[model samples]
Target: MPTTRNFRTRRRRLSWPLIAGIIMLHLAALYGLARALAPDFTAVVEREVVSAFTVTITAPPDPPPPPDNQPEPDEGAAGDPGRDAVPQPVTGQPPKVRVKRDDPLPRASSTGTANQSGAATAGDGTGAAGSGLGTGSGNTGSGRGGVAVTKPVHISGSIDNARDFPVPPGGRAARRGTQVIVRVIVTPDGRARDCRVYRPSPDPEADRITCQLVESRLGFRPATDANGNPVAAPFYWRQEWF
Candidate 1:
């Protein structure tokens, strides 16, 4: 009878590893099915998982610099309106002029003619009338203590048959005429001092006679200095004898 009871006396135990394996296999199959149904499902799940652990922060940009500020110039208070059109009176002191002791003093001309210094001015009418520069009925270079010499010395030589020269006979002067020039040094008193033949004639006798005639007949008005005083001057006298 015991042999006839060949029934199973051993009971099978529960396998926990097989059950965990089966559950993992089912999860993998479900993931595949989700990828097939919606392709972006895995990506969305991974983004949500990362966002839960990560923190993000943003900052604002800086502001620009301030602008420059400057004051404008005033136009109403610039300058005077009539400054350049009208001449203004000088307010400063005049400059000093230095003159040496040896330098001559400047004097105004009394003659009616212009001199080296300045123009002529009218004088007191006393002498002969003058012509040219200013209106003055007076002689020039005749004033005492004048500024400059307005006129030079003059020579007067005239031939007179009765008082002057006598023609030489039987000479070259009588045939072709003889020309003679003499240098006469005049005194301050208007008299001849030294008379010498400057240009001689072909005839020596004519030269001698001409010089003698110059010393006697030639008259001169003496030259005046800057002070209007008479001064000695040289005169060249020329004459022709027939």
Candidate 2:
């Protein structure tokens, strides 16, 4: 029992540090409670603890990929996969175009029917075939298969007889053997317009006389072809003085 008492004394002496730590812990707890009761010390302590341990962890950056050694695209090449191939023309087909030939005019059959014979033998005399104004039939009316006969144009005009028109030094008299060509457009109303001397006479007086006659007294019923249709046409007249 004496040995056990000495061992307990030594054990108590060794436990003095633990007892001091416990006392310090109790004193700190008491001080915290007092501060908390006095003010908002628990909120301040929580804010300080949060600030002390605040951390931001960032992820590392990724490395760049290796470059491929692909060839550059050809600018002129057809690169699209969906595009259709170029079309090739088919062989053995003739090109589309008109073929020209120099064929002669077809001749009428001499041994045709009686109607063709009659047509060939229709136009006889009266300057019909020579004038090229015949309609085969001898009818002279303004209808089908007939000839259109226009009325004769009547023209009269006075000439300046006093004017000698100045003869050239070595040439003949300007008034002698003078001729004028007059062009007149005959309208459907039997009236003329656009009348002028297409060919001038040697004498100025003859040209002036021809122009006055054409402007004043030129008249015509509209000309007609074999079809008997009235058509506006241009007519010419040559006036001559001996």
Candidate 3:
């Protein structure tokens, strides 16, 4: 019975120590919870103290125009405003020209009239002497320089491929003849000067070939005077095919 009483005293002492340990554990848990839920004073003060600002922009007003009394610059005046202030005068005068008159002829008198009458009478053989004097014997009713004028002589010829006067291409068919009237200017030296084809063929090819042939091959003997001398006379030639 004494042992049982001692065991109950020891249980009471152990129960008091356990109660103190439980109380210390509960106080530590409450301190951690309070620290976790509390606000950060330094971060709150920094965020609250910062500030932001907004700005607005505006355009400037235009300046006033310049005065009108100032003279505007001239592009062609080389920066000098008074350069065109001078006035110019014009002079008038007539152009000079030289003039001269022909000399007057001598006046006719009775003596001069009589002399001219005698000269005319002698020339016509109506003077006292019935023979005409001071005249050329060769002065007949012929042309100038005593050369007898003859009529224009006409000559005719032909341009053909068969005869080959101009020698056509070999083995080619002979083209039909083209008649061309050629007028030739006969010079004083008996040579042809200006030879022209006055009339051409109806066919272009025939006209070209005929004109070329006539201009190359045709010639003539000049006409003769009464003295049997070749004279400067006109002539003509005709080219045709039968």
Clashing pairs in 1: none
Off by over 4 Å in 3: 1-148, 151-178, 225-229
lDDT of 2: 0.60
Question: Please, what is the whole-model Cα lDDT of each candidate in the order they appear?
Answer: 0.64, 0.60, 0.51
- Consecutive 10-residue window with the lowest summed lDDT within model 1: 131-140
Model 3 lDDT per residue over 1-242, tens place: 55544343344355877989999999878766665676475456446666333345677888888867977777676653565666688787877776876654445555453423334322433232323432221332112233435643435444545454343444223433546666665533445545666787454454455556555555545565676655545555566654
Specify the poorest-scoring 10-residue window by lDDT in model 3: 135-144
Supply candidate 3's per-residue lDDT for 239.
Answer: 60
Please give the lDDT score for candidate 1.
0.64
The TM-scores, one per candidate, come to 0.34, 0.30, 0.29
Better of 1 and 2 by lDDT: 1
lDDT, candidate 2, 1-242, per-residue tens: 55554343343354888999999999899878878696577678778999999998999889889898999988899866887888898788788798786654336655544433333332454434323333332434222243345532534333444343344444555456767788876654565667788999766655666676665665666766555556456777777665
Model 1 alpha-carbon drift over 4 Å, by segment: 1-157, 160-175
Q: Candidate 3 has which clashing residue pairs, if any?
A: none
TM-score of 2: 0.30
